[model samples]
Target: MTGTTPTAWQQRIDTLLHALADARRDAAAAQAREVALLAEAVEIAQAMAQDAGGPTSVADIPMRSLAAQIGAAARVSDRTVQKHMSDAVVLVERFPATFATWAAGDISRGHVRVVVDAGVGIDDNAARAVFEDAALEVARRETPGRLKPAARLLATRLHLVPLQERHTAAATKREVWVRDLDDGMAELIAILPAAIAHGIRDRLDQYARRVIDARDTTDTRPTDARRISEVRADVFADLLLTGHASPDVSNDAIPADEAIIARVQVTVPALTAVGADDTPAELIGKGPIDTATALRLAGTATGWDRVLTHPVTGTVLAIDRYRPSDHLKRTLRVRDEHCRFPGCRIPTYRSDIDHTTAREHDGPTELTNLAHLCRRHHTLKHHSAWRVRQTPDGILHWTSPTGRHYPEHPARTLVFTTEQAGADIQTGAVSESATASDPPPS
Candidate 1:
C-alpha cells in the first residue's frame, strides 16, 4: 500500500534480521537446534558499537530497559542479562561490519542510549572514531560472530590512553569563620586568584547542594563561622534550623570594647521601667543618646533593639541593617565564595556588603534581601536593573534589565587548562594547547 521504499542497506539488513528471527522461531518450534547464534548476533552488534565508541553495557541507561529485554529473552535475571549484553557489545565492536549490517534501522532511542553509555570507556576522539567507523561498516555488511576479531584488532592498533585519576589533597581541609567587622574587614589584603577561588566556591556549592537539597524548603541552613550556634542555644529554636543563623558569644560574638554605637530593640514597658538616671549609648544612623532620649525610647518602645560592635572580626564584614537578627555577611561568603557577577571573582568575605533592595526601598536585611555581590556587581546593581534576588528555596534569581530571569546553580566542574607553545596564544595565563585531556562535565 505504501509508495515509499526502504534504502538498499536498510532492506538488506532487515532481511537478514528477519531470516535470523525465522531461524530462531523454527528452532523454538522444533526444540532441537541451538539458539546460541541469536545471542551471538546481538553480542556482535554491541561489540561493533563499543568498537565505534558507543556504550556496550546496560549501566549507560538511566533506566536499564535494555538489560530487562535481554533478561526476558534469555530467561535470566536482570544482572545476568546485563552481563551478556555487555559482552555482546564488546564482541560487536571487535567485529564491526557484521554487527553494523543487522542494526541498519534498529538504532532506536534505546539502542542509541546503550551505545552512548558503553562509549564512556572511550575518551579520546581517535579511538571513539574507530569504534564509530566499525559500527557503520558492520551495519553495512550485516555480518556477525567472525566480525568481532576486526574490532579487537582495531583496538589493539590504536593507542588508547588511560584516563586520569588525580588525588586532590587541597579539598581535605576547609577553613570558615565569622566575627565582627574590624579594621581587617575594611582594609584590604592579598586576594586569592579569581579562578582558584571560583573553583573552591564551586566545590563548596556541590557539598551544600548534596546535603541541602535533601532538607525541606522553608528550613534554612546556617553558614559562616557561626554554624556552631546550634551546639549551644542562645539563638531562637526555629532560626537554628533555618539556612540563616546568628553567631553566639562563644562562636565569635565578642564583647564590645570600643563604645561604638549600635541599634537595640527595647520593650515599651521595659524602657519605662529603667531609672531616670539610666542613659543609653548613641543610636546608630541617629545621634548620641542621653537620659531624656533613653527615657523617651524606653517610654515609646516596649524593648530596646540596637546594634552593637562585637570584639572579634574574623570573617564577618558587617551586620545587615534591616534584618539585624539574620546574618547577611555570612550568607555572601557561603553563596558565592567570590563575586557572583560574571568574570569578577573577588572573595565574598573581602567584598563590600550590598543590599538587593536599595536603602530607599524598605528591603529587610535578611539573606533573601542580601547577596555577597562583589564591588563590580554592587555598582552594576546600583546603575542597572540587572536584578539579583534569592528565592526562599535558596536559589539565586538573576534577572536581566530586559526582564529575563536566569536561575544559576553553583558551578561544580573543575577545568584545567594548560598552555602549549604554538601559534595560537589566546590568553596570557595559560597556553591553549590541544593536549590529550578529557576534563569532566562542568
Candidate 2:
C-alpha cells in the first residue's frame, strides 16, 4: 500500500478487478456443484428405473427421463438433465444409500456419475451388491457428503482385476493334423485356456526342435513309438502354427500370441505444475503401440514437450508428457478415458500414448504431449486432420481440420437418458440436433 499512492481511478480499477476475480471463482465453483447435484439425482433415478424396468411406475421413471423432465421444467435439454443424472448414478454407485440419506442436499450429480461408471461392465447383481455394501460402510465411517471416494474404493476392491502381462518365449502345445485319424471318425477336441494351449504349443515346438537337433547331430535311423508320438505332436503343432501360411493346409490358423495392452511408466522430464498440492509433477495419457513400439518409448529419457495450436483456444502453450506419476496418469486416463476420437469408445486402459505435438518437431515427452488413442485412432491421427485438445477441467475436445468440433464424452460424464441415441447410452444421445433435426437415429 506504501509503494506508491494509486490515483483514485486506478484504485477503483484494482478493486473492480479483485471483485471480478472473486465472482468468476465463485461462479466456477457453483457450476461444479450444480453439475454434481444433477449427477446425483440422475443416479437415484436410474437405480429406481433399473429396479422397475423401463420406467412403468411413478417411482420407476428412468433417470434420463426424469432428468429430461427436470431439464424441460428448468428450460434445459434432456441431455443436460441426463448428464446430471449420470452423475447421480456415479454417486449412487459410490455411496449407494446417499440418495435416501443425503437425497435432499449435499451430494451432487458428478459424484453419482463417477460411481455409476466405476460400477459399469460389472454384472448388475454384483454391482448392486458392491454398491449396497460400500454405501453402508461409507455411511457408518465417513460424513454423508464424502461418499464418492468411498464408493469408488469399494468398487475398485470388488470389481477390479489384475493387469499383469505374462510372457512366454517357448512354443506352446499345438494341434498337428493326423491324416490317419482314419482309425477314428469325426471328433472335436476339448477347448482350453490360453495358458493351457500355450503350454501345449511350447512342448510341441520343443519336440520339433529336438527332432531337428537330433537329425542334424548324427546319422540317426530310429523309428520308435515315443519318437512317433513326439513327431505327431510336433507335426500337429507346426500345422497349427502355420496353417494359414500354407493355404493347402487349411484357411484356419492360430496367430502367435501377443499382448493386447501394455502399461509402463517411465521417468521423463516434467513440464508443468499440475496444481498447488502435488509436487514432482506428472502427466498421463495412453495410446496403442505395438510391443516393439512401446518398448521403444519406454527406452526414451527426455520424452517430449512442445507447443502447438490448441484445438479450442487457438493459443499455444507447451504440451506436457504423460510419464511416471499416478495422478498425472489418472488425469490423462479420465480425459482420454477412451481414445480421443469421435465415435470411438475404446477405453484408455487398452490404448497407446500419442503425442499431440509431433515428436519430430522436438516435442518434449510430457502429458500435454500425450493422449490416449486406440490403435485405430492413433493411426487415424497421423492419417487425418483430427486434432485433440485437453481442457483444464480434463475434457478432451476433438476437432477435425474441417472445423467440426466434438467432445469425446468420458464414461464418468455420461448420462443415460432416452435422449441418447439407440439403447447404447454409452454411445450418447443429443438434447436436440446440432443444426436442425436429429441424425434420423442410426
Candidate 3:
C-alpha cells in the first residue's frame, strides 16, 4: 500500500507542535544566557569585595556598588541586580549540578530557583550537595510547582536543627504589611502561623457565605449580590476595622439598627439597576465589579444621581455641558476613571481634573477641555515640557519632554452581551465592548 499524505489538520498539528518545541528551546537558551550573565555578575561582585578589603566570602561583598554597576549596565533596578548576583553565586558555587542542568538547557531558571530556595539554611557543603542532587532529578521530571514542595520537604528533613526550634524562630518574624496599589486600591498582607492564617481565611469564608445568604433572602435589588471573593474581602475588612463580620449587622454587643453603612461610589447601568440588564458596574476607585455587588451597594446608597450615555458607544451623552461646575466635575470623575497621564493609575477619586489647554490661553470651559491627572502629573504638566490635548471622543494625547507621544482613552467597564456570548461559544472568540461613557471635561 502507498503511504498516505498528511491531512491538512494533521499538517497544522505538526506545525503547532514544531512551534511549541521551538519556543521551549528558545526559553532554555535564554535561561542559559541568564546564567552566563549571573556568572559575570558574581565575578564583578567578587572583584569589588577584594577591592574593598573585605573577607573572601561572597556574603561580605559590598553589594551597593556592585548592584549599582550591574544595574546601570543591565538597565535594571539595583535591587533586581542584587538578587541576580546572589542567585548567580549560589548557582555557580553551591548548586553546581542544578546550574549545570540549567546551562545545558535540561531545566529552566524556575527549576534552578526552586533548588536554590529549597537548599537554604543547609550550611554543610556535603548536605547541600546531597540536596541539590536529589532536587535536580525532580526538576527534570516535574513542573516547578510540584518540584518546589518536594524540594522543600527534602530540605526540611535534611535540616540539622529541630523543626520546633525552626517554628519558634519563624514565629518571631510574623508580621503584617500594607502596600498601596494604583486605582486607589491597597493590599494587606499578613505573615502568620499556617494554622492561624488558615483559620482566619476559613472564618472569612464563613462570614462571606452568611452575607451572601442575607443578600439573597432579604435584598430585592438586582445588583446587590456579590461574588464569594468580594464577600470574603468585605468580611476581612469588617473584621479588621470594626471587629464585625457583616457590614449589614453590628457585633453582638452593638444594636442591629446601629449597623454602620459602608460607603462606596459605584456607577451602574440604569437598566441593570432596575433589573432590565445585568451589565457589570464600575466602582469609582476599584474598577468593574459584578452587577450583584453593584446592586447591593446601590441598595444601601443614601443618594442617587442619574448619568446618561450613548446606547451603542456607551459614551456619556448628557452632562452639565454649560460650564466648569460640580456636575461637570462629577461627570469627569465617572468618565476618566483614573489619571489621564500615560501609565499613571491614580484613581479619579484621588485625581484632579485639569484643563488640557491653559485657561489663561483662552481654553474653553467645555467637556472636551478637561482631563484627570494625579497631583504629581498635574504639576509635571504645568512645569515640565509635557503637553496634552483632548479629542472630541475624550481621548487624551500626551507629548513628553523628549517628543514621545502617547494616546490615552477613558477606562470603560466590559459588558458581555448575549450576542457576544453566543459568538464566543460558536467561534471561540470573545469580544470586549465598552460599557461606560465619559462626557468631555470643562
Candidate 4:
C-alpha cells in the first residue's frame, strides 16, 4: 500500500516510543509520588528545625540546609531545588485542580508554572477558583505564552484594583541597564512600558525584513547574507552607537529617533477602547496589553481601521477603512496581519502583498488570489521549490519543499496596526554617534 519504507534506526525509535506508551501514562502518578515525597521532606525538615531549636526560622533562614542538601543530590542549584519544592507544595496544596490535571499529564510543567504564577496573587477563594477554571481551559489548548492573555484577563478581573491606577504606579519604574557578556557579546536591557518595548522590537523586525526582502528580490550581486535575527541585533547596535541601522545593508541610515516612528498592529475590543472594561488589547505577534495604554495610543492615532468579527467565534468578518486609503491594500493588511507563511510572524507594514498565483500565469488581482507574504517567503515561493495556495476563505495552505502542508489562517482579529502617534519623535540628539562608528563599507 505504501512505497516508502522507514530506515532501521527510525523504525527502532518508533517502536521504542510506542512500547513506552504505558510508561508515559504513568507519569502523572510519578509526579504525584515526587511532589508528595518532596513535600513530606519539607515538612520533616521543618519538624527537625523545631526539634533542633525554637522559632523554626533560624538565623533568618528557612529550609536552606535541606534545600541545599537536596540540590547537591539532584545536581542543581539550591535555589532551583527550593523553588521546585515550593512549587510542588503549592501545586498540591493551593491549586488542587491544576495539580490534578498536571498529575494526569494533560498539561506540562510550563502550563503549571504559568497558572501558578498568574493566580498566586489571588487570595479570595471564590475569585481564585474562577481564575483557575478559566485559566485551565486556556492552558489545555494553548502554549504557556498563548495562555498568558486569558490568565492575565482572569487575574485582572479578579483584582479589585483598577487597572488605570495600577498602570500609573507601575509606569514609574521604567529604566535601562546593560550587562557585558562573553565572546564580545553584551546584553542591553530596558524596562520600558509594554507598548513602547513591543513597538521598538516591531520596528527592528520591519527594518530587518525590508533589507532581507531586498536581498532576496534584488537583481544586483547581493553581498549581505545575514539572517533576520542577526540583522536585528546589528541594527540595534548600530542604531544605539550611530543613531541609525548600519547603512552597509541597505543605506537604511535613517536616524533612530526618526525611525522611532514605528507602526504596530493593536487589536482593541470595542468596549475596551471606550473604557467600558479592561479586556486587554493585543499586539498581533505580541501578547495582551493593558487597556489604558491601548486607549492612550488609539486616542492620538493618525488613522485606524474598524474590523468587524463574528461575535461568537471571534473570526474577522469584515474590515471598514476609517482613514482614506486604497481599500484593497488596507483589507489585505488586516486579513494578512502578518506573513501568510506558516509560523512567520513578520507584520504587514514591512511585508509584500503577494499574488498567490503568479500574475504572469493569468492569475487575476482579486481577493482569492492575493495574500501577504514577507519578502523571504515571497522569494522562496518564486525561486525555491516551496508552493502556496489560498482558499476563498483566506487560509493560505503551504506545501513546503519537502511536501509537508501547513495551513496559515487569516489573522483572527477585529482591528490591527494603526498609524501610530508620536511619529515626530526626533533622533537629532542621538545623531552624534554617526561619527563614532566607521562609515558603511564601500
TM-scores for all candidates? 0.24, 0.26, 0.48, 0.68
Candidate 4 per-residue lDDT, tens place, 338-385, comes to: 777765666676588788999999988987899888899889899976
Show model 4 residue runs off by greater than 4 Å.
1-33, 50-53, 56-62, 215-225, 249-260, 308-318, 323-442
Ranked by lDDT, the better of candidates 3 and 4 is 4
How big is the positional error of residue 160 in model 2, measured in Å on the Cα after superposition?
Answer: 5.6
For residue 190, model 4's alpha carbon misses the true position, in angstroms, by 0.9
Regions more than 4 Å wrong, model 2: 1-13, 43-64, 91-294, 298-442
Better candidate number, 2 or 3, judged by lDDT: 3
Model number with the top lDDT: 4
Model 3 regions lying over 4 Å from their true place: 1-7, 48-69, 180-184, 206-221, 241-244, 247-442
Ranking by lDDT: 4, 3, 2, 1
- Cα lDDT tens digits for candidate 1, 1-442: 2554445545665677678867654543332112234355455555555565645464355324656765677788978765655555553554343234234343222333333333435656656565545434432222222223223322322324311111122233434445557776532132332223433344334333323333323244345333332232322222335533233322322223411111231211122234421112222111122333334444443222222211111122222234333344433443344455543445554366666676678887776666566677788878865777766533467776545565642211011111211123233322110001111112
Clash statistics: count for each candidate? 59, 63, 11, 1
Kindly give the stretch of ten consecutive residues in candidate 4 with the minimal lDDT sum.
Answer: 431-440
